[model samples]
Target: MTKVVLTVDDSRTMRDMLRLALAEASFEVVQAVDGVHGLEVLSQTEPDVIITDINMPNMDGFGFIEAVRRDERRRGTPILVLTTESDAAKKQRARAAGATGWIVKPFDPAKLVDAVRRVAA
Candidate 1:
């Protein structure tokens, strides 16, 4: 079965890049503009993996991950934080908030696909 991935980011360019990469890898892609929209989309779809940006307008990735972890149904779903920030403290924080992995911005298509495959349930 084709894996489903939800990507949440504030940048249209990022979203488009992600969609192209994942789609080319044969994964179904769902997109949201920010954490708020991510949650809204999450309620409607059961994605195999979720990739989110750390900085967003409403509810950053940390908050989104925390909220997802709070839900029993989504507790086991793997969330990958993809952002420009490479701070170790922020990475630790993301892990605490329930992120499965971290990927920096300007991600390589192959690596992104690999990470999704490795984490997707």
Candidate 2:
């Protein structure tokens, strides 16, 4: 089965890059502009895994993760925080918000794919 991955980022370039990488890995990719859009997309698609950027316009990754976890059906969905921020405090915050994993930006496609496979397994 083709695993679906939802990627949320404010950068168009990053979103395009992610789509290319995930698609090359044979994963079905769904995208959103930011955390708010991410939630909207989530309403329609139960993706196997979710990758989101921390800083966004309407809502941030932490808020998005918390909202997702609030939904009983999506509480277990693996959420990977993909962002440029390497702050330990932010990582902890994301973890507390229910993120399953973290990946720094300018991510290695192979490692990102591996992380997704591991978590989505």
Candidate 3:
């Protein structure tokens, strides 16, 4: 089955890039503008994986991960943090909140897709 992927980011460009990359990898892509929007989208679709940015308005990635982990249905879903932030503290925090993996922004499309495949598999 083709995997469904939810990408949450405030930047239109980032979301577009992610859409293209994931779509090319044969994954169906769902987009959200921020963490709040992400959760709303999550309620409507059962995505196999979630890719999120750390610095979105309304709710940041850490909070988003925590919220997803709290939800019983989505708690096991793999969440990959895609952001420009490379701070070790932030990465640690995201992991603490239940992120499955982290990818630096300006990501390599193939690597991103591979990471998704590994986690979603």
Candidate 4:
């Protein structure tokens, strides 16, 4: 089965970038504007992986991760954090919140694809 991936970010450009990369990597893409919208999208479609931004308007990445972990259906889904923040503390918090991995912003598309492939597998 083809892997489906959810890319959640407030920025259209970021979502588009991830879409292009994942598409080339042969994964189906689903987009969401923020964490709230992402959760709604998740309810309708179960993606193999979720790539989300840390800071957003309605709900932040941390909150989203917490929610996903709490949801029985989404608990095992691999969630990768895509953010500009490189602080170790922030990474630690994200890890504690159950993020599968962290991808720093201005990411290399190839690396991103590989990471997603690895996590989704």
Angstrom error of the Cα, residue 66, model 1: value is 0.4
**lDDT, residue 64, model 4:** 92
Model 2 residue 36 distance off true place after TM-score fit, in angstroms: 1.0
Q: How close is candidate 4 to the true structure, as a TM-score?
A: 0.98
Better of 1 and 2 by TM-score: 2
Question: What's model 4's overall lDDT?
Answer: 0.94
Provide the TM-score for each candidate, comma-separated: 0.98, 0.99, 0.99, 0.98
Better of 2 and 4 by TM-score: 2
Give the per-residue lDDT of model 1 (tens digit) for 39-105: 9999999999999999999899999999999999999999999999999999999999999999998
Residue 113 of model 4, lDDT score: 93
Worst 10 residues of 2 by lDDT: 56-65
- Tell me, what's the RMSD of every candidate? 0.7, 0.5, 0.5, 0.6
Clash count, candidate 1: 0
Candidate 2 whole-model C-alpha lDDT, 0 to 1: 0.96
lDDT for each candidate structure? 0.95, 0.96, 0.96, 0.94
* lDDT for 87 (candidate 4): 95
Q: List where candidate 4 sits over 4 angstroms from the true fold.
A: none
lDDT at 116 for candidate 3? 98
Candidate 3 local Cα displacement, residue 110, angstroms? 0.5
How do the residues 4-91 of candidate 3 rate in per-residue lDDT, one tens digit apiece?
9999999999999999999999999999999999999999999999999999899999999999999999889999999999999999
RMSD in angstroms, candidate 3?
Answer: 0.5
